[model samples]
Target: MDQRTNRTFICSVLFIDIVECSTKPVEEQIWLKERFNALLSETIKDIAVNDRILLDTGDGAALGFLGDPEDALFVAMELRDSAMNDQRDPSLSLSIRMGINLGPVKLVKDINQQLNLIGDGINVAQRIMSFADPGKLLVSRSYYEVISCLSQEYAKLFSDEGLHADKHVRQHRIYAVGHYEFKKATIGVPVSRKTAPEPKEAPLTDQPQQGENRSIDTQASRYRKTITLLLATLPQRPFHKKWISAAIPLAILVVLFAAFALRGGKGTTENPSSPKVVTAVPRPKPSVTRVAPPDTKKTEPLRSTDPSISQPLSSKRVARIGFTLSAVERKGLDITLTVSLKNTAADARSVALYDNHYSWPKSHLTDKGGRSYEVQEVYFRKGGKRISMYDTGKTGIPINGGATVTAHLVFRKFPDSSREAVLNLHPFIYYGWRWTEHDVNFPDISLE
Candidate 1:
């Protein structure tokens, strides 16, 4: 376990790989590497050196951020923007793919006594990068889980690309950042006069099939012709009002005969031979219940038979606050949950998400067996504003009157045997000028 006595910690690693670098000529490859290094350095200059470690991978590079996970994301976005805007030379265009992962890494010294990293953290980061297309940014599910909750803006930037299987057959769920076009941009630095080779054409297999195209076109033409004939004939009446009146009387007689026929078959209707049609109806959603204070009379417990019911908690402050458990996801030892909070008051109220400065814990998860898991992080988002876990301010995020806000909470060391858990929120919400220690519990949350 002491592979490196130096230090072992979890960090967000950004892995970048230059596309098709091996096919380039010796002189062009050298120039491309130089330009990439310069751009990467410029993008990360604002980030402190002590908080990050950079590893060169010959074709590309990896950066492990030991501080906030957002640091790696910021650098990735900046590097992409800078690479796209560089205008040095037309031949020096570059295309790169990036991937980010949050995992465990060990700080070790290389043969040259230089600091190096080795672990699943950077390895998975590289795997994630390998799945990306040129000019695109992809992030592992672990990284997305942490960073997306930091802010609503960050969350909106990600679109789920679904699950992918790597070479090792390990399934990875990845999220793609905002779309990007693979365009070339040059910088001001002078380079060799050699012109870059043109991109190769797509393989024949990627092209559309001629037979399939012809079939589709024929079907479309027939549909268009049929529609044109109908449109051309609609204006001409097939028969006048006199014909319509005669046809209506015959139609009513036919309807009357059919009604009489059905009435004569009432005996058969009592036990029809035809099968019955069963319509599927959706189940009603569970209602949100307000948690009463201890002094208040005890309420009836929810019927334990229904799995769809969720017992939520609430506050009885001047503005009633209610919570509805939205989603719960468990991956390995981590547990992530989203709770929707609604405020019924007329004005916005400040609610503390988490306060590190306070002595007591703000929230946690407990199982039926009484095992408790500590809350690792919390993020609160309301409208366009977001509150990060690292915020130092005492006042928490504000929930507008009658507005609903979402709170994402992450817990570590989840109990493996527990299929149901309870989330307890304590002393975080403000009732008036002072902080209220009233305990709120959301019970019987299904973890399966």
Candidate 2:
């Protein structure tokens, strides 16, 4: 096979390692690797083949993401969840550690003319993984700085773990990954186009990932082009010049005629001969009406369709639309609430509950102690695809008039001391190009 020249690029790399594969027996080791490979494939199935490069490392593997940086975080979260949640074959369960870094990597052909990755990017990723505990994921400071600034949701997923020194005495700062449902972060933020630094012998090109060449023209660009085109065609259109010269006098006459007609055809009504009379109308003084606050402490019988779910109060409609509390479940540090949106309108309306790219009226949980918990993720079905709210490719979900749609909202686990909580939900209904916010507060919700 013909070998291609080596190329260096700036990208994000993920390094994973089995906890103790070498200590296991040969049969168990084979089973472990097989299970790991299968899980990894499922985790990264949604990503494109060309956007990522995988290199087998015997026990674990290294993944280089040539696309978005958040791709690495998603894969890591999914892999960790799958490994810990696998209940089958308790004796041979797998545990792995992961690390992510954003740095420069060199792609070259190995002895067999196959693609291989070698550089400080992969090396630092391995070092970061070493600092992680079993079934944990850690990331270097470089990766954290770039990703955290992208969106508020991404920033909430990381916490600084301080700096650690490696064997070579080189210090590296790392951040521990917090527990979160696997959801896509907003990718609208612009990244630097700088490339990896190269040696004196070979220089790397200053460009980012491919497919970025197809940027769409903005409104400003189109307006500027239209103005330039009009200027270039003005001199060639002799008829337009003559038309403008003749239209000036015609426009003046039309303005004078409209002015004369506007005065009831009396002509110069403001003159001394026809003095105008002005009367002042007094405006009514503004009156203030005081509204009583809602009784949050008032409790009603538990109303729920499912016995496992508990609703302390009756659910009310927001914006003439109703939401039925279908289910509420708690597992570990996660709480999932399911609801169905009922539309009573005669026509279809587009609805948007959540999105990371744009800030909207949010839904959250507040305990009796006044502790608030923000929503971690939202799930719904659109066009037969399960989507994360605000992370969907489309702008909103469409529901026909008199139709209903079911959605699930995942929130951080409630504290044990807080046996009851209140939920504030904000959902937006789309009106052509505009959005209208309809908020509902469900108080006295039993968490126990």
Best by lDDT: 2
lDDT of 1 at 406: 75
What TM-score fits each model? 0.41, 0.41
Candidate 1 segments exceeding 4 Å error: 1-5, 179-448
- lDDT tens digits, residue span 257-355, model 2: 544665775654454333222111122232222323336566662444463654423556754567776667767567777777777787777666773
- Against the true structure, candidate 2 reaches a TM-score of 0.41
Kindly give the stretch of ten consecutive residues in candidate 2 with the minimal lDDT sum. Answer: 190-199
lDDT score of residue 153 within candidate 1: 37
lDDT of each: 0.64, 0.66
- Pairs that collide, model 2: 355-390
